[model samples]
Target: MRKYPIGIQDFEKIRKENFLYIDKTQSIYNLIASGNYYFLSRPRRFGKSLLLSTIKEIFSGNRELFKDLWIYNQWNWEQKHPVIHLRLSKLDYQKLGLYEALSIEIGILAKEQGVELESKHLKGRFEELIRKASANGKVVILIDEYDKPITDYLDDLGKVEENRSIFKSFYSVLKDSDPYIRLLLITGVSRFPKVSIFSDLNNLNDITIHRKYATIAGITQQELERDFADEIAEIQQHQPDFLGKLKSWYNGYAWHEEAERVYNPFSLLKYMDGRDFRNYWFHTGTPTWLVNIMKQNREYDLENVHIGENALSSFNVEHIAVIPVLFQTGYLTIKGYNSNNRLYKLGYPNTEVRESLTDALLSAYRNVFPGNDSMSVTDDLSESLKKNDMPQMIKALDVLLSTIPYDHWKAESESIFHIIVHLSFKRLGFDVRSEVHSATGRCDVLVFTDRYIFALELKLNSSANVALDQIFEKGYLRPYQMDARKKIAIGINFSSEKRNVQDYLVKELE
Candidate 1:
């Protein structure tokens, strides 16, 4: 069996060490041929660094590394260009600051090319390097994680703005030195607005959502089947449903409306290594600041988060919003796109994200670390729901709610309880919808399982019977009556004083 390159981002190292590599050289060929300046935004650990490194190797005329790769014969080996590759993620901006890091990186690039800079500023040094490097041949500028410096300081707005100013000035050199550049490519986790990073470089083509390049940074199903045929065969021998389960857990990322689905390369590789399905991608780096921002803003209702094509690409960290940040960071993905309306519906990509993100939100809302407490409770709740054990389900949820810290009960609205119940069901891999509309009125929560349909109504400072009465009075279960699955109505009341479930009731609808 060949070694899987889990953390190896260097193209030459992978080729030299004989690590398992997926062929993405065709995409690189198309990328260079299609545009001079390009920008691609993808989630972290989705192989952006590897993509950049591969591009560097191609531009630097490393033909030996592409021994059996697709672009070996097609690429012009004679046309060698000076490659100035800078990976911002390698620097700790929190310690050195953006200006210092930028200066040090640019200085190193200059020292490599034996070029001298007239000015000490980052902008001047960058411009001077491009001019000198391109004097012989046009310079191929490759930047990886361009937004890392700015995103690192998301919590500190003053520092973030300062870094943005430095980036704006530094990157403006790309536009100014366009004549001296052969190809400029930037890859990052998020794409900020023009006023933020690419204000001057308006001509930079953003192929993030382009159908052709959608699979550039991810592993498509075809690539998986083609590259890991042996592994798949072995897994199928041991686990018959391995492929189906694998697809459910980590696949289904679509950039365009009709684009083919792609899997998270990091998680897929990790799963392949151990044959254990886990939230490898989400655990890599939880968006703590992103979750905190959503919690602080009280943006709990995320089921209907919609954005037009324009708004989806508009990401500004300074004025942080939930939709753009979550979508860009891989917490949510494109579910559906309405061509007529030009609006995109966003949701969690797969079970890993759907379960893990809700768990993160649960932790943030309760102001408690998500140890085994919540997980155990959700597990018990799911089993109870499966067996039609209403009392056990209620007990599990009430116990879980009681664990929330008293001081965390700051919200007086009923949405808090609604959101908690919704998240709990969602975390357990149950289909849950909050504020779902019915003919009579909107239901507080609707849960769907293979054998049961649960309609729940939650009341804050009222009797459980009152909530139950409202469920029947409002005809909340009417829509599910015609379905073949068993229908159940549940009511729960919460007390702000106790910071736990006050009472609960459940009824089966005939």
Candidate 2:
């Protein structure tokens, strides 16, 4: 019945309080022995700070705190090194630029070690801190959210570069103190390219997308059941099906081994606390900032879905000589990869992220209204599915055609009009295709149900005859006409001037 350190990132505080902790120490134990400087990139609140604290604990030779834990019995506890933990995320992102923020961070970590930075210059101050740690013995460097400042200023390219410059010099100090460093482990939301933040330390091992350790930071489903079973049971008491709810809300993050899945640790805990499956993962971090990056780059697609790796990863923010800022930021993650192709499928990491992102996109990308409007339009299609009403479905093209927002085009919303209609009908369980090829040209939309295929064209102040003729001349419905399902040609004209469906046309294809 110990307290769970829900958002508490400090190891000492959480440990002394006897809070519930799922052991992730083995990875640290392995990591320390494995490399001198290790860079790990995980999503926000995936327990990076806690991991940093855990490293501090291990390095301090605080073996007594780890009784019955995996590392205590597994590791040789005879060794303990002096640890210098610098938490960088604590600085105010808006109030200070990179230099000032680094100064504050250095001062705090140095204060704990009884060595203050009396100098104003960053290099001079960091030199003093490193000297203190080395004077005591090699420092075990642990930095949390190392990229917060740059990421905060992602919109302001000026600041991203400034922050990168500041960190480059700051982290380079580690290279100078390479001899005194016992184990250097830095955690951030995403990995910067070698030339940027870690410029001074090119050899820094980046284990962000490394398949071997993706599970190190987040909670495994097994761990959740084992450590928080009671909490889950407690939360589920109000729900008829708690397990299903948990799975749907939180069970879709996969980060390793070609095929691995994980729940978002931050969201999962809060959901346990409130017993409501809120978007605990998006709790004011990662998503919107990522959305900003997309908006700035104009890379987020409203119409199509992409599954290729490096699709969004190629856009580099100015003055940043590193990995694509997007991948490091946790908005995009490796989905699946083929060894032969060296190609990876990148996507939003989990079910919660996908749905949360979709909800955000629906609001940001499209103008979808709430509720079952699609069912009203497709009830006949639904019936057609049941009764196999190809004839009725093909004939219903006229009625379906009538649903276009003709006024929306004259209004000139551009992409908004097309995106809304496609998403609207997509909700009805039809494979909502957009920009489909036709005899006259490309149709704006083509919704295909089990019973019939629909070809639609949307335009501002365009007539149904033009939309329908495009369908007929371009042979938009020709490809699907031979299918067992009835073929239907429907032309929809949208008025950009207004945002509602204005006119639609439907015709049967042989």
Candidate 3:
């Protein structure tokens, strides 16, 4: 029974403690062979720290840690380089300022390596530490979550700019110390432009979307099946569709549009340990700022977002774009790419993000905390849809709508009702598409379930009869005529005065 290294980011500890380590040394070897300076951007808990830790151990000549791994024989163990490992997420920037926190961290590293620095400021000390640590050989620098200081204070413009300035000064040492550095790999959740580290360090290769190293950070499908074969077999005994369900729930994260999708390793491990399917990764931490941003930009659809390659790569902190932030933070991922136009199509990575993010956005819109009764109401709506209980479904939807604050409903447009209803069904984990277009006409929403398909038309300050007539008149159900599931047509009307569903009609179609 091999132990899962849940929340454990230390490579040496995982190997020595007999944890089930997914061998990523092959990718690491390729990375080292390909470049000396690299930057990786991945969402939180996707094993960026572990990757850096593994590289640190490798450079430190930890041969025993890679005994059975791919790099054990491939690497030249005789060649050892001093490593300067810094995890910005672990730094005390909140208590101490960025400059002081970084100074202490570098000082500790220098102390560990038995080196003394005479420099007074961060830039000089960092340069001094690198040159001294490379006395025997060039130093390998691993900086994990390098942008944490800036990201942590996004709500405060002054603090963000201050941290940016501090980072710009501190990282300026890297370009001058290149001769003393063997390899530098910086991992973070986002790459902000004008950080100077990026502009000054012109040699740094950003492999965030590079096809060759797309699978370097996340656990690919092959790795998952190859690694957790025993766990899968055991789970399949009771849940026969376990593999398929798992893929649907968690295995759709892709960095390159053509690369194989990977699973959120943290969430996968949690599911393996508990044998329960929940929002493991999203629950660990969803940035309140991200949720607030989504609430402010409610008009932007979360699916099929198209962005240019350059625009998708980096954004400035002063002018942040929600789509790029969503993509960088793992809420969205590359789904398709057009080489001719250099455009990337992005969407929700998988069911986990779609459902969890929708719930969070709904909570923000309602001005309530998460885990409110709206979630249970959505659950009730799901149950009603599963049983084809039209009356119960309408009642549940009404309750959900009633919970929304009056300010949200002040707009009193059909689109708002459509968005709320779409979000409600989407949060229920159904296959939902809003403003679906067909040859004849467009439908307000279309919901697909295992046993039923629904064509819905929404109207505000109008009668449900008119909405139902439009649904049939527009031939919204024509496209799903051949679908095997039971087909139903639903029309709903919302009253601005009541701020809830006023009337709804549901009809079965052959």
Computed on alpha carbons, the lDDT of every model, listed in order, comes to 0.85, 0.65, 0.87
lDDT of 1 by residue, 222-290 (tens): 999999999999889979888999999999887876788899999999998988888899888886777
Candidate 3 segments whose C-alpha is farther than 4 A from its true place? 193-196, 371-373, 386-388, 405-411, 438-441, 450-452, 478-487, 507-510
- Ten contiguous residues minimizing lDDT sum, candidate 1: 369-378
Clashing pairs in 1: none
Candidate 2, residue 392: the lDDT equals 62
- Residue 57 in candidate 1, Cα distance off native in Å: 0.7
Report per-prediction Cα RMSD to one decimal. 1.7, 5.8, 2.2
lDDT string, candidate 3, 349-414, tens digits: 988998888888777766675555257668888888899999998888788778876765554468
TM-scores of all candidate predictions against the true structure: 0.96, 0.78, 0.94
Each prediction's number of clashing residue pairs: 0, 34, 0
Q: Output the number of the lDDT-best candidate.
A: 3
Better of 1 and 3 by lDDT: 3
Q: Model 3 RMSD to the real structure?
A: 2.2
